[model samples]
Target: MKSILNRRNVALSGGPSRLLAVAHDAATQRTAAASDAAAHDPHAASASGSPADSVVEIESRAEPAAGATLPGEGASGPRPVSTLHAVPVMPAHLNGRPVQIADGAAFEALRAADELTTFRVYRCFAYTVSLFFHPPTLGYFVALHQESVLWRALKANDLDAAGSAFHLMQEQATRLADGETRRAQLVAQNAELARLIEESETQAERLRVDLQRHSEQEQTVTGRQHQVRKEVAQLEAQRIAAQAQLNKAHRALHQLKVATSEGVPHLHAR
Candidate 1:
């Protein structure tokens, strides 16, 4: 067995350091190249200058070197790194947005506002067994989350702090989900209220139309009544005039009869 294949390294450090992840796709090519190189060059079979059994280098620096390939990264080149307070934990993207990690009062604001990520990079170690045969394409596999003390603890290998951050993340996720559900409920309620208002307005419009129709009918009936009363009054006046004419004729006939009778008696006496 090749000593390179047989041996492996796990790295840890106290205090503060940054975590760099290996890219998955380029990981396979590096080992195969080493194996091919050994097969071609007899001198390369010694494995003296070979990488230190996939050991990740941990060292103190104020900030990570830009575009620096992690030791043993080979063709994968420099690993990408982000800043965390003292201990480093990169952030993950959620809902297509990269989570932001702010330090000091800004991070406090995120904690108070509850707009932070829950994911943490607790451990960055080779999965072993399989790494000897078939290493994952990416050399370093870890996590990213924003503005978490728990993340720093995880980086420093603090088990208790990591656990606390895990629980807090779960709670925040629950709260956000509940808030979204409540908003949906309120929207449905508003729609229902608007529908009811529209129905009431429609009913009111129908009532107004009926009232107007009734008013027009009442006006027609009132006009008809006035016409009928006027006709009655005119008829009554004609009837009174006819009565007066009849009385005048009756008086004339009575006077003429009396005059004829007196004249006939006078003739007889003569």
Candidate 2:
């Protein structure tokens, strides 16, 4: 029963240093008690094992053996402290800092004041403070957590402190959310700009290709025009030479006819 009590205490503390100290003390006490019994009767030493063995047994009971777990714990380890209490033993951080929240009546007052404020920010994150009114303590217990991890908690009879903490956490959470939103917007805008730049570059490249093709076409058309002009000049020269030869033939025919008429006697036109 005493060993069981020691084990319960060790489990409740859940600190390795504390467990070691408690185990050592229990072992020393058991060793002294065993030594006393053994001195009283020499046969008692043989009946019960050595004092060293008793001490070892006490120490073992005081602390779980390596790789062993307490009742209700898995082989991995004991459950987190938050599971047993309203808040974590060590709170997790957000952006390298923990958020503070107020509990109970203070939380209600802050919420009411927030509604009246013109610039209201929405709660975009899952962090929140929960409150429970304790009849026995006549106080409010405030817990800040997201999922299974509790970030901060307090019990306050003074509602103002709890309210201040709750609103502060709310503000911190909103600021983080707004920052994330801005970052996302910037990233999207940059991506859109990059896409536009790539599209413009592609269009410019296509225009360059079209310009090159049109230049080649113009060069081919200019060469064809030059060749056509040369052919037209040659045709014009040939037509002029043909006309001169025909005129010479006509003149010769006229001279021959006149000579024949003069040689023969000719009657005047009557």
Candidate 3:
């Protein structure tokens, strides 16, 4: 009887243990399934409850095709980029030279200003400042402005505005360079034109001198022609006087011959 009781207690305890093992196994399996389901369902971990499905959302947000300006975007007004009113404090040696700033400070300052204005200021300063030593400050300012504009545009759901801002920044830089190049070309062209004009004037002066010399030569020729005509007239007058003297001499000779003939016949007869 004692042995039978012990056997029955052992059987009952073994049954509960088997049942518990089965329950634990089922619970573990269920937990694994739930984990698998959660893994498959991407929305499970997302804040918006649904995971981004499209390739675009997975990569980057979509932008509008046509370039358009959204409302309340970019610089406040169409004002020119401002100048650097004050330089940050630096060591005595770097006071007058380009000064480097902490990236954080530069970024904060750029973020506080208008995006367009900030970009303009950066560009303006970049033109005047050396970027090598001041790379941190310049890079920070550019990144800050870019992020601010991008964030603002995205928040407002204004893709066009964001694109426009980016394009405007690029265009403004290009235009500035173009303007400088054009000005230089204009200056060179003006100088060339001035030089050409001077050369033309010089040539004209030389031509004028040649013309004046030619005119003098013409006058001299005219005077020589007049003297030649006067000489011709004097020679014609002398020829006419010589012809008259010859005629008178011929007449006297004829008279003398006739008188001689008549006197010879009279003397012979005497």
Candidate 4:
């Protein structure tokens, strides 16, 4: 998605940060310059008192014209009031990354409309960068990261390269966000897979226990079959012995009957 400038953004145009940073630096310089001037120029100190006195004097006579003199103000005649304009300063860092201020086209345009803009300056590596202002939206963007060559091109005033780098930076940021999201998703998926593997192992363990029980039952059945076979064999042998004994008794009885008949016949004949 094309990003809308919010917490993260930048415009790699003409020296925007350079201009903003300069503007900010200019304000501080102006105050320092004023102090220096006051100390060095006796006439200035006589007219406007001192740097400390000038501040108070300016505050009291906010609308006094330059060269306007105060009553009882010694020999230096009337002293013009110092200009009281605001000095613009950009933030020192963007999202914890150290940055250096550079010039930008957008800032130049805004500086042209100085009455309307609150421009800012920044540092991009060893290079300087800038930001634009819009009174209507009251919004601006701070670039989190930029391509190395992109900043170099922007510094060299290579707008073509700068624009390309800007686009590349956008893509880089989106890809990074996507990469993190995918990583998180993979981590969650891996956790789920690990859980499934654990459950499968538990089920396999139960099946193994069931298989062991079945094997033991089978062994018991096999042992019983062997015992029954031995008992059948013994019963078969006992039956065979009983039959033989009965047959022997029968034979003896038959022989005894024959002998008795023979003895009776002999007695009758006599």
The C-alpha lDDT values of all candidates are 0.46, 0.62, 0.46, 0.50
- What are the per-residue Cα lDDT tens digits for candidate 2 across 1-270? 475565556566663334556667767787788878888987987787787876676666655543345454465664557545475465433334443334435545543454212122224556554554545445554555555355555555545554555566676666756777788799999999999999999999999999998999899999999998998898888878878888898889899998887999867997
Q: Would you estimate the TM-scores of all the predictions? A: 0.30, 0.38, 0.34, 0.30
- lDDT by residue (tens digit), candidate 4, 1-270: 022111012222211122233333444555687778876886875575445453443333322222233333435645558999999874344334323343455544454666233233444333333333345444332233244222321211223333333454445455656756688789999999999999999999999999999999999999999999999999989989989988998999999999888877445555
lDDT of model number 4 = 0.50
Candidate 2: how many backbone clashes?
Answer: 7
What lDDT would candidate 1 get against the real structure? Answer: 0.46
Per lDDT, the best of the predicted structures is 2
Q: Which 10-residue window in model 4 sums to the lowest lDDT?
A: 1-10
Check candidate 2 and list the clashing pairs. Answer: 101-165, 101-166, 102-162, 102-165, 102-166, 103-162, 106-163
lDDT of 1 by residue, 1-270 (tens): 232222211212222112332311223445566677888985875654552233322112111432343354535655458775786665644333333332345434544565444434222121110000002221111222333332321121233433444444445444545666688789999999999999999999999999999999899999999999999999999999999999999999999999888867445555
- Writing each residue's lDDT as its tens digit, candidate 3 over 46-97 gives 5333232322232222122112232333246364587868776643122132
Better of 1 and 4 by lDDT: 4
Candidate 1 global Cα RMSD: 24.5
Better of 3 and 4 by TM-score: 3
User: Against the true structure, whose TM-score is highest?
Assistant: 2
